[model samples]
Target chain A: MALFLVNVLDGFVTGLLLFMLCSGLTLIFSMMGVLNFAHASFYMLGAYFAYQISLVTGFWAGLLIAPLIVGVIGALIERYGLRRVHKYGHVPELIFTFGLALLIEETVQFFWGKSQLPFSEPAALDFAAFAIAGNAFPAYKVFMIAVAMGIFLTLLYILTKTRIGMTIQAALSYPETVQNLGHNVPLVFMCVFGVGTAMAGLAGVIAGPVLGVFPGMALQLGSIVFVTIVIGGLGSLWGALVASLIIGWLQTFATAYDITAEQVLTAIGFTKPELIWDHPLQDLWTLTLPQLGPILPYLLMIIVLVLRPQGLMGNRES
Target chain B: MNKFNLMMATALAAGLAAGAAVAQEKVRIAFIDPLSGPFATTGTQGLAIYRHSVKELVNEPGALLDGQAEFEMVPFDNKISAKESLIQLQVAMDQGIRIIAQGASSGVANALTEAVAKHNRRNPDDPVIFLNHSAVDPALTNDKCQFWHFRFDANADIKMDALTDDIAANPDIKKVYVIGQDYSFGKAVAAAAQRFLKEKRPDIEIVGNELHPIGKVKDFTPYARKIVGSGADAVITGNWGGDMVGLGKAVMGAGFDKPIYTYYGATSGITAAFGEEGDGIVKLVGAGQVNPAPTPEAQEFIEAFYVSFPDLDFGQPQMANVAPMLAAAINEVGNATDIKAIAYALEGMEYDSIVTGKTVMRESDHQAIQTVTVQGQTPEAAFEYDKSGRGMVAETVVELASNDAPTTCEMKRP
Candidate 1:
């Protein structure tokens, strides 16, 4: 039971990290009508920026300043780069961000080399907060959960309660109508992009220490961020949250357990076949839980897609 | 005033041209390796070693070749791809470069080896010799050996032979967990470790063996937890790069206090990545040590290299011999451009490496037989300075490798 509880908390922490990235991405997709494929690259920039800042001023200063710097850079790119690409059509806009992602990865490699940096967790949070069943849960993990929760709540309050939130919702469906009502639609888009990227940057700064600050971090987390947004359904922040949590829990739990295909076959009343290597489904028989851990999220995504065309919290269209 | 400056520049250019005209002609070795991309630092480090060797051994008047040969090292970026390496090979051939020095990825090395062997068979008159400095996959020396591909470093099995010998002697490591990247090299390491440990210490139990996809997993926390939970006394891995960093951090973070044995660690930013977490806990098996150099020349080379390239360290000190040996081979053949003769000459060659004393190139498999060291990171106070400002110290140094491993190379020599 203690192990289960620990796993639950771990899954929650991982889920919240994913949510921190997806919430901004879902918002950007809703407002701009073009998928920002470079979203995870923004996450990468956040980590690198924080790492550099931490080197000079320590982790606290990095926490306070890195995302703001990322926000400004993101705003500039949206204003100058993406704004020009927007007029060409969504295809071109998608292509632009895709190209931007590649450019950012190369630029990062050019500067940082292809190695993980020594951007470790602060010394204060280095010890275990608690131990369950003889296994200690790290204090840094508690800190991660706290930050993720804070970001989730702040995002919830802003998107649901604020006047800008209402404006953003209105702009999502009727950009022309919002512009007709005397609001600067282009300014709104730029603000959304900047804020979304800043959110991603915040995720990067905090998670960088835990996830490791490396050139490959972006590539590792890039597709998963998109998967979160997709499986949660586009334009639905609530859906993104749900999908992130589900995928996170699924992955963590899958890794926590040690189930093998042989167990399933035996449970189904099938006799174990000797010389499994000679069997037709040898790979299937040899597969185990830890090996399947990374794939569990995608398996969940497949199930979700087949069951509901719209995600759990996604909108039902005509 | 402008005309005078222009005339002075022209005169300087002419003087250099006249000096070059009187100088000896060169034997070019096309370095078809990564000059840019993720592996650029490694490639550039190798290129530096080659350049240093040329300056000290080949270019100097009283050189190893005795000024009979002036070898030029040309750079070509393979981008660390097999296909790209073949493309660069063609480009090198087009430019009339007959010797290729490449090492970084075993994948790229294999591609270059096969391509060169085919080139030798198809176009014997224009054969290109390959000198591999690193890439330690055993199959390259075993089943997949080629006449043209000669490796300067010992193979994976040889390194494992020394490592398992040391590990078996350590009574503390009764339980070992094996984890590596899910690729050919990683699998080979895992298999080799299991085979070697079973042979050396039959009582040592392999508690767990896991293979994660190369560069795919973000966090290795789950893997670390499993290692910790398994009650394993030690861990062995063949992971490198970001994967190594992530795994090492997670393992150390989880408070798994035992030593983690690795094939590629203690250098290439890993020491930096480990920081204080790896003072003595993370151990590695490799060719040489950076500090406490065995010879004065090597010590001078290390000092000068660090002074010039402060950001990089000589990861594989065996690479120091890459150019020297190539020069010796050219001298042996009495002709620098005689590719086949040079290839044959490289066979069974012996040299006293500054790092490892006596190193031999095995004639049968083209695998260099040399002393290997197992070392761990030490504080900066222990050594003056390393690339990470903290150098490594050797735990075990095998004077001569016990390389009794058999090979399947049935070479049809031309």
Candidate 2:
């Protein structure tokens, strides 16, 4: 029973992290309609920036300042780099972001080297949060959960209850109509992109210590953010939330329970199994979520695309 | 009639000279790794070793590869992709590189093996010989073993076998928990440990078996919980780099309060991340550190490496040193870079190495029979080892295993 609760909590925490990253991606995709493949790169950059800032001004300063810096950079990229590429159509835009992601990863390697950097836990949150059924959970995890939840709530408030939020929603649905009303649609796009990237950066900062800041962090997490967005429905924040929760929980539960596809097949009374004598494929049965974590979000995205094109709570029918 | 005969003899002599010149030319050796990706550090290290060895062995004053002839270490950055490795290998082959020293990743190694095997079947005389120094997959040297591929490092079985006796003898170890990265190396180590424990000490309860992906794992809290709850006396793990360090820190912070036996052993990579957390952690290691009392050859290698790269610390220097040793072996055996000749020379060849002691590259599997070192970390002293009652000193802990033990290859030596 305790193991089940722990798994649930783990899923919740993981889902919250996914939401933090996917929410920004969804907002940007809604407004721009150009899937930023480099979205996770921004998150990685945020973590690196936070790590640097934390080194000088401490973790608190990093948490506050790094996101703002990331936002500014995101805005700049939209205005200068992305705007030029937008002319080449959606395919070009996607390709540009992919190239940008590759460049960012290389740049990270140049700066940080290929080795995993030492990102220690903050002194204050170094100890255990509390013991549950003789198992101690680290206080840092509790802090991560708090921060993720806080970000989610704040993002929700901004998107729903603010003047900028209304403009963002309008621009996502009908850019021409919003532009006809004399509102600067491009400006909204720039801001949304910046804000979305900033959120990713914030996630990076918070996750840097735990994940161990490296060049590959973005590449590993970037596709998952896309999965989260797809599962949640492209532009719908609520859809993203539902999808993120589902993905996070599904992955955690799947891995924790050790329920494999083969096992499922076997459970459904498939007697006389054809032992394929395949080594590597046979090795796949032993795989779990953490093992499959890098690819899980993509799998979910494909599933969503095929089953429910509109996503969990997606606004658009397509 | 005399003038015609003289002219014909001169033309024949010219043709013979051309053939000799072609035979004397050095064959190219390609080295590929993730020079641009997140795993570029491993690639860079591999590149350095290959480059250094090629330079020392092929381009030196008394060179080996082509008898004072020049050969290049054609390095390409695969960026940690199986597809990219294939592309890079083709590029190397296109550029006339017929020999390769493979990088760290098993995926890359497997890709290269298939590509090379296909190439060799078509042109057997001009074949690509892969000298795998880093990839520790047992299958590479076992069931899926290739004739052209030769592994240099101690495979998973050898390393596991080296430590099993010591672990089995320990009375304090009642229950063992196995945790590894959910990859080839991890699964192999976990499976090997389980098999060995089952066969040797069936009474020793394996309480928990936990695995997380190599780089995908962020928080190790729940996994730690599972381990602590397993009522384990000791933990046997093969987590390397970030995972190893992060888990160590998590284990310490969570207060697991048990002896952890790490598989990567006393590698500098692990220590660089989890400095004090590595304290009291027992690890199976290969190269002895320079700070502790090392062999005379090891001291010489360190000094030479320091002169070449003043910024390099002692721990990483062994990687650099391994290159020169490999070079020296090549020089002693073959005076040509012909893969066949070099391959023949390397078979059943024994060399006194700076890092590994009495290294013997076997004729059968081409697996090197190198001395193994087991060391335990000590707290209070930064990066200091406790070799007292631990039985992990150079004289005490280092064990030399025969090549016949792990290798399945039946050789017909030239």
Off by over 4 Å in 1: A180-182, A266-280, A316-318, B1-23, B380-387
| TM-score of chain A, all candidates | 0.96, 0.90
lDDT of 2 by residue, B309-410 (tens): 342233332343334444554666554445566666666677665566667766667676776655566543222321111222332244455445755655
Clashing pairs in 2: A47-A204, A232-A239, B65-B336, B65-B337
Screening candidate 1 with a backbone cut-off below 3 angstroms (N, C-alpha, C), the clashing residue pairs are none
- DockQ (Cα-based) for each candidate: 0.51, 0.34
CAPRI category for model 2: acceptable
lDDT at A129, model 2: 85
Whole-model alpha-carbon lDDT for candidate 2: 0.70
